[model samples]
Every structure is written in structure tokens, then in C-alpha cells.
Target: MTKTITAVGFNFDEKQSEMIEKKLQRVSYAEEHIIDLIVRVKHEKEYSFDIVANFRWGVQANVKAEDFDFGAALNKVMDVLDQKIKKEKEKVQQH
Candidate 1:
């Protein structure tokens, strides 16, 4: 069961939201376990992206990154999230 993601940002529109979704799909994760995805975006000197992935199985991962470019920030956060998800998945499996 894939949870709906809430992407909130400062000065954002539909296109930006779609961009975020597409970026998410670019990564490989077992998203069906995700209970919620809260994405916070901001521009404080540079583009900042944060993702909070809450799993229904009680695994939550939070990642934040900043870069000069929006795509870079997004990529960095996703990479962190991916690593976190992998670790959580392995932990769950070991249980």
C-alpha cells in the first residue's frame, strides 16, 4: 500500500510537485511500505530538500540536503533516503 506523499514547498506550483514525484520514481525502494512521504522544499541561500519517509511497519527515515541547484538537492536527499530505506528493510527482514 503506497501512501500518498505530501510535497510542500515555498513558491512551488504543479510542475515542481510533478518534478518531485518523478524524481522519487527514479529511485528504487519498496515504496509500498511507505505510510507517508513528507517533502519539504525551501531556498535559503541555496535549494534545500528534505524527505521524511514513514513506514507503516514503524520505520521512519528523514533526510535533508542543500545544493546550489534544485535537482542536486533533490538527488542528494533521495540518495540518503535510499540508503536509509535499504538499512531499514534489512533490519525488518532480520527480525
Candidate 2:
């Protein structure tokens, strides 16, 4: 069965929240097995974002980034998480 992926937005306006949700949906594929995702955004002089991706196996991957805008920070965090997940999968395959 395909896993359920949930994306949460914190301190985000309607437009930003919708944008983030759509961006996350791009990664919500069957092979990812991401059961849930908690996306927290903090806006200040410097924006900060934290993404917690929960897997069915109880493995939670987290990524954080800071930038001038919350959306940019979120994108950076997503990029990091993408690489992190890829590396983790490679490790698992090698074992």
C-alpha cells in the first residue's frame, strides 16, 4: 500500500503554505515510503525551516535551513533531505 504523507506548515500564510505543500507533494512518491512530514517555518529577519520526514520503519529524517525568506529556506532543507535520503538508501543497499 502507498504510505500516507502529511505536510504541516507553521507560521505560513495561505500562499506560502500552499506553495510548500505542493513542493512537498512532489516527493510523496510510493518508493519514498514517507508516512508523514512535518514542515515548520519560522519567519524572522532570517527565515528558518525544519522538515521532519517520518518513515514507516520509524526512521525520521530531519532537515533545517535558514535564509532571507521562509520559502527559500524550505527549499534548501528539502534539497539537503533529498541528498540525505539518497545517501541513507545507498548505505542500506550496501549492507
Candidate 3:
């Protein structure tokens, strides 16, 4: 799967990037079914994350989460993303 991570309003260091990569690994099982996985992070008064999962079968799932803490926001977003992906996978399997 093609993965892209973009950060706005701040620079992400290697450690932060690595942390994101590790978090993303949780969804690696769906790599073949997913076409593109895009994650956008923005920081202002709080940390916000937007994740989009484009499936190979023309389904798209978008999830968003925000928190005052970076790790919390990331975890929240990923958890939702995981659920969305699982739901989509089930749909694909049923068809």
C-alpha cells in the first residue's frame, strides 16, 4: 500500500515519524486491500489528525480525531481507522 504522512504548522522529527510509522503498523494487515493510506496532522491550539483509507475496491474511509496530547490524538484516530477498515473488509468479503 502507498502511505503518506503530512504535518502542518510544525516539523516532525525522526522520532515522531518513527512513532507514526509504528502506529501505522497496526493496520498493515490490510495493506493489500488498501490503495492509499493518507494521514494529515495539524497542530494549533490542539493536535488534530485526518486519516483517509482508499481501498482497492473503490471504497474510501475517512476518520478524524483531535486532542491536546499528540499521542492521544494519534491513538484515537488510529483506533477509529482500524474499525473503519475492518467494517470495509467485511463488506468486501460479503460481496
Indicate which candidate wins on TM-score: 3
Model 3 scores worst on lDDT over the 10 consecutive residues at 11-20
lDDT of 3 at 14: 91
Candidate order by decreasing TM-score: 3, 1, 2
Worst 10 residues of 1 by lDDT: 1-10
TM-score of candidate 1 against the unseen true structure:
0.80
Q: What's the CA error at residue 76 for candidate 2, in Å? A: 0.6
Per-residue lDDT for 71-91 in model 1, tens only?
788888988988888888888
Q: What is the TM-score of each candidate against the true structure?
A: 0.80, 0.72, 0.97
lDDT by residue (tens digit), candidate 2, 1-95: 23223334335568876777677666655245666667666665677777777766667788889999767777888788788667666766686
The residue ranges of model 2 lying beyond 4 angstroms of the native Cα positions read: 1-10, 30-32
- Which wins on TM-score, candidate 1 or candidate 2? 1
User: Per lDDT, what order, best first?
Assistant: 3, 1, 2
Clashing pairs in 1: none
- Model 2: residue 77 alpha-carbon error in angstroms: 1.1
| Model 3, runs deviating above 4 Å | none
Best by lDDT: 3
